[model samples]
Target chain A: MTQPIEKIETPKGERFIIPIGPQHPALKEPGHFEFTVDGETVKDATVRLGYVHRGIEKATESRNYIQNLYLLERICGICSHTHAMTYSLGVEKLAGVEAPPRAQAIRVIVAELERIHSHMLWLGVAAHEAGFDTLFMYSWRDRETVMDLLELLSGNRVNYSANVLGGVKFDITPEQAGDVLKGLDFLEGRNRHYLDVVSNDALLLGRIRGVGVMTQADAERLGAIGPTARASGVALDVRIDAPYIAYKDFQPALITETAGDLEARFKVRVREIEESIRLIRLLLEHLPEGELVARMPRRIPAGEAISRVEAPRGEAFYFIKSNGTDTPARVKVRTPTIFNMATVLSLAKGLQLADMPMILVGIDPCFSCNDRMVTVREAERAETWTWNELREHGIKVYQR
Target chain B: MSNLVDQITAGLKTWARVNSPWVIHFNSGSCNGCDIEILATLTPRYDLERFGVKLQGSPRHADVLVCTGPVTRQARERLIRIYEQMPEPKFVVAVGSCAVSGGVFEGCYNVMGGIDRVIPVHAFIPGCPPRPEAIIDGVVKLLSSLQSPAPVQPIMGPDGGKA
Candidate 1:
């Protein structure tokens, strides 16, 4: 399905070079891409990232397994649990310790909750980008209900620090369980309203439909994943494909869309949120009775294993190479944003400059958690402009 | 239709400016330590809005700029642009260990070390993305600082109107 990079000549002799992001209001992360355009069509695009690289991979080498859990959580605030979950699974495999059944269930619950929060957040951002301000406000306000539930379960709201090496650090009581159920019920109803807004809203559909079209073949060739790949009819989700944690016990329902556009991605995420709600209900009902933590090994064995978790974003893969120590010898993370960023540039081409914000925010690039920039030359001559200068320049040109 | 009405209007404006601070966040390139904490403040636990702080999407509509990460070479210009877009009388709050001193990324290439190199930082909230409570505390402290009136300009001597 890989399409060769083709070049098309246009009537206009001058080539169009559109540089998007690195500091765009539409993008939450910092990554830049330059698209070569001919007339209104995108001819080619080159992506440039590493703007928010903090050298976390190198920093991980210095921290122990316990410390690395916090470091991994810092990877992405929304998918903090998945990072810790995958890291713990990888290290546990090396240490030869299976988490207790109760702990496993708790992990599943937390992971699903994280997925719910992430998708709702994405929905709000996407809505905001498409100029649907009311949807943005409602979605973000609804997301707080899930955050409150998570806070009730674990002490912290964002970084729950629930996942440990052998088991979860916290447990839920009967009262807390009731609160969670009530929250979920409220979310379920609110989600239905969201579905109506996303599906039928004329403005949203107009902006997203038929925009940023990526073929199934293009997605596979680029290794696009999560909703991005699924939206392109690639039925690939790590939770179902490679079962990990309690996902093996309760498989997640994979949602796919054949039409690969912004609307398709939106549909996939919305459907997944519903699936997560159902999964959470089923998990809470089938709560197994057992101890939370098993005995964890003091030292890990000298071996390497790869663990992948379907984070809210996509397949969050963690490669842990242990050397029979409390700290790992090598730990590498392949976040989903790294792969999806490529598709953002591709989809951005041929689209009007005004539509760029919606397309950029659709991928939800977590540049801060992933890449670190490396300056090649200290004395390189590059033109720099301030925000005021750019705004003034833009105003002058647009006013005319 | 008098001086009383004008005084009341000015008082309301001052009160709104002090109570409701709209913050625009910019990530120059540090580890996401501070950004998470900033978001945490918005959650129900901290409920930063109850204190009248709100997160804004664009710099033009912002009253305060909460910046995280050590400014890297790639992000330096962008950071400056975002800062300049904001209106005057704006305050800058640098959050996290990285934003304060670049923390571990201080000596690394691409990193400019601290956010102050690019923008005028009004306050520093330290801690690898200081705790949520700490972020709230920092914002509150920044508000208190803004409450103080500007220092009177030094009177110039009659000789050439120079100090």
Candidate 2:
């Protein structure tokens, strides 16, 4: 499955193939990457994912709308809120209902707060990949502020199960709002210091500056989204382009950098942290007073609905189909990582093998988020296995 | 005198292993909820290293295998291989709800339920994704259990067989 492409063969008879994962130290999740390198320079790269594929889409069909809400939230722990929110917004659309204004505003607050946690998490991971443990430690140490804020709003630290069918599960009190603001103030200062270190610090700049330079044209050509494309000067943000929920009232200031290098990705994300801080503050100041959840019917009408929202990494998309039953007919999730994965392959060529981790982390690749399906292709035919067939096949293999 | 020296050496080795238990984390098929929290345990706030639990890169050098999520079929073989690679007397800590009992991912076609299906798990930290403190407590308890007079036997599977 991880065979190196033959077409990109080098002039030399012998090729140095480096297979990175499925279980590599650099990657926290399970993914397989085969890079064809010429001495230290990479000539071609191919990635094989599905190591962390849990069949969440198939699982969603069996579960009801409410159960699926929690199921989808587990798609990517970093962007768990985005997944739940996207699914809920689509389900609510299918049900012909909208969450109350207060619920919508609270959703935005949590989403932005999740974004802060995600970006900080990414910053730490990227720094760790760069061998800058100091920045990694400091950034993650401060990330707890946002994590605490999320916990304060909703109970859990990671899953946060904040979204339900038509609205959110909880409302932020005046005291919780005060706590969130205090945390954000502290985060804003730490993020500013991080921004300075990532941009101006001589040692850190050496590892990031001018490395993995993905031009704006290349980024757009390869369908790069989120901070990865924004760093390349592509002004594609789901919040700004199509306002959903409370985004229509509380808009986020676009943060983009023209460098399109690893440094730009760092800058754009760090700057966006400040931007998210401002958006959360504004939303808290004018949080609408209303019901948390609107009335949603148990059985949704037979129809199809699409939901799109800006996740921390990029735009998270969902397609939900209902059959007038309690359970959904089908649920298709297209996470942002899939869209941005192409950038890594394109950028892999002509770069040193050492810069691979930095380039890979630049897109914030989430294997679990993107590994939704495995298409088995055979010679002269392609086949789709039914649930029963798949189960039998699994049983047969395990029995062997 | 030789028997006494051997006992003292074994005691010293246990003390060292308990105090500085190196861990290697693997996401078998998890949502990464547990993986990140496990990471949080190491960072400054939680400071899991205070107990000398270092997150290692290679399984060969690790003392404990920190497994997250339900074991997916694709990752099961690799999980077994990783568990096998660690030096003998290794401890496996299954973190998160998915890892313990497959939790919400129980009926998923691709999921193989818990990590214990493929490997022996010494400690089970049950949470959707357990909090860092919970993870810390789980590891600490696993370490302290080594202080027992008898060696802990591997938990048997339902079929009364070792994985």
In angstroms, give how far residue A266 of model 1 lies from its true place.
0.9
Across A40-82, the per-residue lDDT of candidate 2 in tens digits comes to: 5778988775556778899999998889988888887788899
- List DockQ for all candidates: 0.18, 0.39
**Whole-model alpha-carbon lDDT for candidate 1:** 0.74
Query: Please, what are the lDDT tens digits per residue for candidate 1 over residues B39-128?
Result: 657755467999888885567788888888777776777678778889976888888877777765665555667776666777888876
- My TM-score estimates for the predictions, one after another, are 0.80, 0.90
User: Per-residue error at B122 for model 1, in Å?
Assistant: 3.6
Q: Which portions of model 1 show Cα errors greater than 4 Å?
A: A1-13, A23-30, A366-400, B1-23, B30-63, B70-90, B96-121, B124-137, B149-163
Report the lDDT tens digits of candidate 2 across residue range B31-140: 77888898888999999999998876567788999888888778788788878889988998889888888889899998888887778778889998889999999999
Model 2 DockQ class = acceptable
Estimate, for each residue in A60-137, the C-alpha lDDT of model 1 and write its tens digit. Answer: 777888888887786666788988999999988888889998899999999999999888888875675565767766
TM-score, cand. 2? 0.90
